[model samples]
Target: MKKTILGLWLLACLSLNALAENIYPISREMGSGTRSAFVDIFEIYKSVNNKKIDAIAQKIEITNSTGIMLTSVANSKNSIGYISLGALNNSIKPISINGVIPSVENITNKSYTIFRNFNVVTKLSNPLIEDFLAYTVSLEAKPIIQKAGYISVSKGNFKSKNPRGKLIIAGSSSVTPLMEKLKESYVKINPNADIEISQSDSTIGVNSVIEGIADIGMVSREVKESELKKGVKPQVLAIDGLAIIVNHQNPITNLTKEQVRKIFLGEITTWEQIQ
Candidate 1:
């Protein structure tokens, strides 16, 4: 009878250990293009049957920065989150959705539907800003953007002369990493220009441009119609993708699009449910 009791206690301990592991769903905060694009591609709101937005609003963690999202997921063995594909590295494991792995070729060929534009917004009247915009979309910036894990929008022969003035670039944290890389390259060539960057979300970026606080706003998604009415002009610079990532220790991978949507909707609650 003592042996039987010992066996039962051991079994209970194992069961308790298993039950202790909970799945964590991490999400980007509102005004994030990464979040917006992710929601649109997954049809998350629609998938919940026009259900309460709380289906998404109630994520286990809400991050305003992509770096935070990366850290949050990387630290938790059961945490899952999404981030710009350009920012993806070995710190976390990117999972395949609907059997599609996020990659440049997949996005370019339209096989991966999780892509969005990196846009720069400025007033339509500034020639200097226009010149900078031209530089961003030109052949000169293509290799730079490609090496940063993004695809430039188009190839053009235009060359931009450095405008020797102070300029501020702010917006979407999703675009900030790649933009920082581009800024490093741009500043090296244009030593006379003083440029500053901010890594807030997209809405604030648009507002900054409208309020005249920022010379240019770096947004990861298209400008909103309301912002267009406010006289903000957005120019597409490059195309980027968002990757759904989990801790490298997580055993489950290769979720279907439906499964991911459902997971965020709170319909699928535990690691056990997914397994």
Candidate 2:
């Protein structure tokens, strides 16, 4: 215990000495719904000639997908990033924000404030697509979604009408994990239905549906009004907390909303500063 304390003290001192050098903050690339929701939730913007422009610090590392975000944090020291709580695993440590752990109960009860909608988009839905979508919003999918650490919001019963067809679902990597589980359960009951998912960013998911390439698009954030204008309908499947994660080696656990906002905005640029 003494040695561990001494080591941490020494490290903190080193971080203090270089207040703006080593700490790395990671975020998703632009056009990502997860990034959009994060910026909105945290109010990460600035007025430029009266227009509110996104003002994420230039130094923040950008990853393309939730998988990349997890891997980047796991491999890098003094790194911080965020991903869907449903996707969290043992590779990284998720820290509490404002003393509230990102859990299903907290998200469902509305205590954990950092959360976003898990939306599924569709354009000119076919009968097969509608049937599968019906299954997604029914009570049967509730346990599967909840089991994946997301807050299931649907309460309905679905009886598959023996629909048979092939369909594609593409979109936000953040929503893919839960969607995959839901797909597995749906396919078992409706054996004639075939579904393939292509993993990518949220923007691509919306566009793909608009272009008539995919029957369904999974997006981590709510479907934008701009997207709605394109004649696509969005179905919110569940609610998910955006889990702030760090390398497992990091010791500090909790951060205030203000602290996180500052860190990503380049105001708090070091581990010691956050400490």
Query: Which numbered prediction scores highest in lDDT against the true structure?
Result: 2
Q: Which stretches of candidate 2 lie over 4 Å from their true place?
A: 1-21, 48-51
TM-score of model number 2: 0.92
TM per prediction: 0.87, 0.92
Clashes (N, CA, C under 3 Å) per candidate: 0, 0
Model 2 per-residue lDDT tens digits across residues 102-157: 89888878889999999999988678988998898899888898889888787699
Q: Model 1 segments beyond 4 Å from truth?
A: 1-20, 46-55
| Model 1, CA-based lDDT | 0.81
Per-candidate Cα lDDT values, in order, are 0.81, 0.88
List model 1 lDDT by residue over 6-88, tens digit each: 99999777655553577789999888878887887776774356452434747457988998999999999888889898999
